[model samples]
Target: MNSLSPDSKEKTQKRVWEYPVPIVKGDNPEQVDAYLTGTIDEPSYYNELCHVLGTAEEGHSVTLHINTPGGIVDTALMVAEAIENSKASVTANIYGTVASAGTVIALACDDLVTSRHVSFMIHNYSGGMQGKGHEMKARQKYTDAHLSSVFNYYYGGFLTEEEMERVIEGSDIWIGAEEVAKRWQDKLKKAEGSDNG
Candidate 1:
């Protein structure tokens, strides 16, 4: 009887294990259910990200490629937390643009790599409220406080306390790849050193 060839065995082994790529590319323009404009707000997005991180293959890094203009703060935070808690190394690649909450998610990665033209924006989170005048003001205040806490929680890790304060004070803070690289080099370097140690 003829024995199974090496190539046949390799193909069989390859079929046994399937590695998943969980990057979410927003729906295309021609797609019927497409909502490509603005930020992504699908709850499934957060769930999928968590699942990918949780099921990542051992000894391999997970690269989250992002190009988003930012979206719901809570969802972004959830995704960021999933990335932060992942056992595998998480690297974020800023392909085109990452603004607002997107920037926060990028910072949660163990390593951030960006292309030359990549840009990110940092700004306070804002949401609309529908209520009576008095209730509206109270709601707004509550929202502002929550946003502030998020800013402090996320930026505190990547930026100096003073730097974070400055960014928070701005109406909108935009940083290019070069500026981001310069500002976070020290933190990234330290992380690398600690990982090696």
Candidate 2:
């Protein structure tokens, strides 16, 4: 896994100072222009997301629209932590397909909205490594620990222990909008009921 840090040149890109609602006209919503296309990585993506989340005015909730196939685990985890710690309500909209790291981001949001056809894939994090016997075993252990930490972190409040185990053991967990909506609604209802009671 690569370490995520802001590059000197990354500072030059135009910062998004306001929360943007996805629009069909004008600029492409999917592309983070400041970071450039095909430059998807931990540092740049994480910094850009932080800029967007941080720039949101205090006491105002922000909606984040995501359409990604996922990227680095560390970056995703950092973004999730930011969302969790934010005082403002963070709502995430899955505009397209969210896989791996992207799914992790959605899980962090206070409310998750998904398009009719939007898809979410959740699977254990994986990466290729170039090394010899002992080194390979060490890398595998590192990856396992990283994945375990992430599972524990995100599912701590959102999912039961058994549910978390199911997610981890499943080969590929793909959830559509309707299923996600029902689950979210149920969770929200439970919270509301608890508050009222």
Best by lDDT: 1
- Give me the overall lDDT of model 1: 0.69
Report the C-alpha lDDT of model 1 over 1-197, residue by residue, as the tens digit.
78779999777556533322234323331111111124757656557567766665546467667778888887787878877877767787786778887888888887788879988788777667787999999988787778778887777546667767776576677788898777667767766788799
What are the lDDT scores of the predictions, listed in order?
Answer: 0.69, 0.65
Q: Give a tens-digit lDDT track for model 2, residues 103-145.
A: 7777788888779998877777667888798999998887877
Clashing pairs in 2: none
Model 2: residues with Cα > 4 Å off, grouped in runs? 1-40, 55-57, 155-163, 187-197
Q: Candidate 1: minimum summed lDDT over ten consecutive residues — where?
A: 28-37
Q: For each candidate, what TM-score against the reference?
A: 0.70, 0.67
Clash totals for all candidate models:
0, 0
